[model samples]
Target: MDVVVIGQIARDLAVRVDEVPGPGAAVAVRERIEVLGGKGANQAVALAQLGCRPALVGVVGDDRHADEVLARAVADGIDTRAVVRCPGTRTGLIIDVVDGGGRWRYLQDLPEAVLLTAADVAAAAPAFTTADAVVVQLQQPLPAVCAAADRGRRAGATVVLDGAPPDPGARSDLLARCDVLRADDSEAGLWADAEIGSALDALRVARELRARGPRMVVLGAGSEGNVVVWPDGEAVIPLGDADVVDTTGGGDAFTAGIVAALHEGPEAAARYGSAAAVLTVSHTGGRPNLSREEVAHRARP
Candidate 1:
């Protein structure tokens, strides 16, 4: 399948340490991994690994880091033909620090130039037109997100939205253009306007969201898992059992999984998403190491 992922593209540096050092203190970094990252790139990478031909549409700085990341994306079987490189802008960077407790802190250096603009989306029209599914990261500017969704809809593609709209004013219009919506914990709470402490609370909120526009709404309900609501039914799929090492890119992978397996139905989407989350959290960094073989093998009994 041809999938288009609209989001960020940047460098990622992940460090694993026993504990975060105190102010001015020193601690040995147990492991260090640097790879291609950003929510959009992560999802595109996961989609590519799941047997989809993914085209990534995002911005990067015209710097050495940009070259490295684009090269890596190409090596990973992602089409970077739509990736923009802005001159005089430094490439985005994210430093993920994980402690033994499984908590993570990120030092991010993403500037405005790394963000997508409406013109960029317009320029990538050909990519959107060829896509069977289009996944948009709502963290981008309102114009860009809206443009991407509208283009996908015009092309008769399955438009999936991740995160919340950039602005409340455009939320309704944007949501109306998408077929599926995936919201993380913070975004879900924002949609609920309150803490979603239980799966039922998430289901109620998801049901409300499903009415807004999207045919399916999935909300993260903290430790309980993900709640999915569709036109005919709803389901609360709990997190899978796994040794979680870090949760930096769990949601990204879950979104990819859902979009990848959506043809099977909502139940399959939820199961695949939960399985992808488990696999992602079992790793050390936000860069997902996913494959259709491993995911299906691990998800099944």
Candidate 2:
């Protein structure tokens, strides 16, 4: 993959339970399903589906699940050489609960998931150096992610940052290093200090964020579509409606699609990205990422 992704790779244990649990209340549920997940892994898969070979850098436990993860990555055509095997830890796993209304909730206990060390980051630098773009998510330690982004920039690659799993304390220096910034509407509010209530508001918020560092900012509004704000101006990327299945990974798919479309042009990038995201929300988990042909078909006028 020409895109290098740095962050967490984990397994998700999802269940359909009753309403959200209160302080000390117990809720009963139905069934549970375990799937390979983690935002970084999801984005890498999404990027691969878009015809970009993605290289993922992260630490996974030397367990069966870890082996499966590595195998899956290779099978999906993602580079697996940079994945570190932490000898004693188990693979990171998240507990996700969905209610009758399809409201999703998460509880993460990443015992086996460890942030990449400086040495680990150094080992993966070469991959970023040769890639067209290095993609980053907040699943890894801030310092590690910063280092990777810096390395990618030094290597003359576009540093795309997706600042989700929102952190209130992210450093401005790192923000300054980003070239393309993507975030959800709520995250746009946290960065711009404005309520991104509508698509126009979200575009404004993205423009505001551009002043801080990134040359371009994209605000993902889920079913509302997306907005791209740059130094020149802003435009809303339209999307066709679909029966939403799972909201998870829609934004990641969007990020992946945009990165893939970077090889084309901005307009194509935005349209393909919107299509990928809309299609993602129509499926289950983060798998079944839309291929370039699928994205192209959806993006057609």
Candidate 3:
């Protein structure tokens, strides 16, 4: 299946720290590295790695970093033709701090990414029109995302939203435009009036979120598994056993997996997402070394 991913494309600087420093406390960095990351880029890469043709539509600066990011995406078999190069702006950057226990915190500067406008989405109409599904990461401008969703719907393609809408008031409208909505615990809490700690709580939130507009709602509850609520019914898909490494892009990977497997029912797609996430958290960086064969192998009992 062909998928179009629209969101931020960032150059990530990752550092290993003993711990997150307390207020004004100094902490030594154990290691430092750079990688291609961003919710949109990660999901696009994951989709390509899973044997799907993915076209990325986003903005980056006219700089060496932009060249590197696009180069990597192309090397990974992603179609970067829709990615725009904005002159006089620096590429988006993200600083990821990973602690000893594998927890991570992010500091991002997404100036150019957030500047993506409706015109940019319109320019990529061909990609959206031909896609089987359009995956939008809510990191970009809300208007741009909404525009892409409208185009996808008009083209009779599935509209998948990977994150929560920035404006709470627009939540219902955004959800209504999406065929599938995937949100983390925090985002789900914002949309639903519930604290998602247990599977039952997640199910409650998923049901509530589904009512907002999406035909299917998937709520990720870390190790507790994912709660999927569809018009027909609901189910809880458990995560697989894997050595935890870094969870920087686990959610994005899960979103990609689900989007790629959407031809199946929501329950089966959730299982595919669970398998993809299991492989993601076992590696470092937001874009891990993943393959469709490995994910399918891991999914098997």
- The lDDT per prediction is 0.91, 0.78, 0.86
**Model 2 per-residue lDDT tens digits across residues 1-301:** 4889987788877777657778989887676667667888888888888788899998889889998888888888889888889989988877777776667777886873466776788987678768889988865676677888888899889999886533567646767889988887777777776667788788767767788898888886644777887777677886667677667777788888889887666666777778888898775555546777888899764
RMSD of each: 1.1, 2.8, 2.0
lDDT of 1 by residue, 1-301 (tens): 9999999998999999999999999899999999999999999999988889999999999889999999999999999999999999999999999999999999999999999999999999889878899999988998899899899999999999999767877767877899999998789887667888888888888988889899999999888988889999888888889899999999999999999889878877877877888999998899888888778766553
Sequence-dependent TM-score of model 1: 0.98
Model 1 deviation from native, Cα RMSD in Å: 1.1
Give the 10-residue window scoring lowest on summed lDDT in candidate 2: 163-172
How large an RMSD does model 3 have? 2.0
lDDT: the better of candidates 2 and 3: 3
lDDT of 2 at 176: 89
**For this target, which candidate reaches the highest TM-score against the unseen true structure?**
1
Off by over 4 Å in 2: 15-33, 164-171
Q: What is the TM-score of each candidate against the true structure?
A: 0.98, 0.89, 0.93
Clashing pairs in 1: none
lDDT for each residue of candidate 3 in 32-144, tens digit (9 for 90 to 100):
87888888889988998888899999899998999998998899889999898998889999998899899998898988444678999999988976789999888677899
Query: Global CA lDDT of candidate 3, please?
Result: 0.86
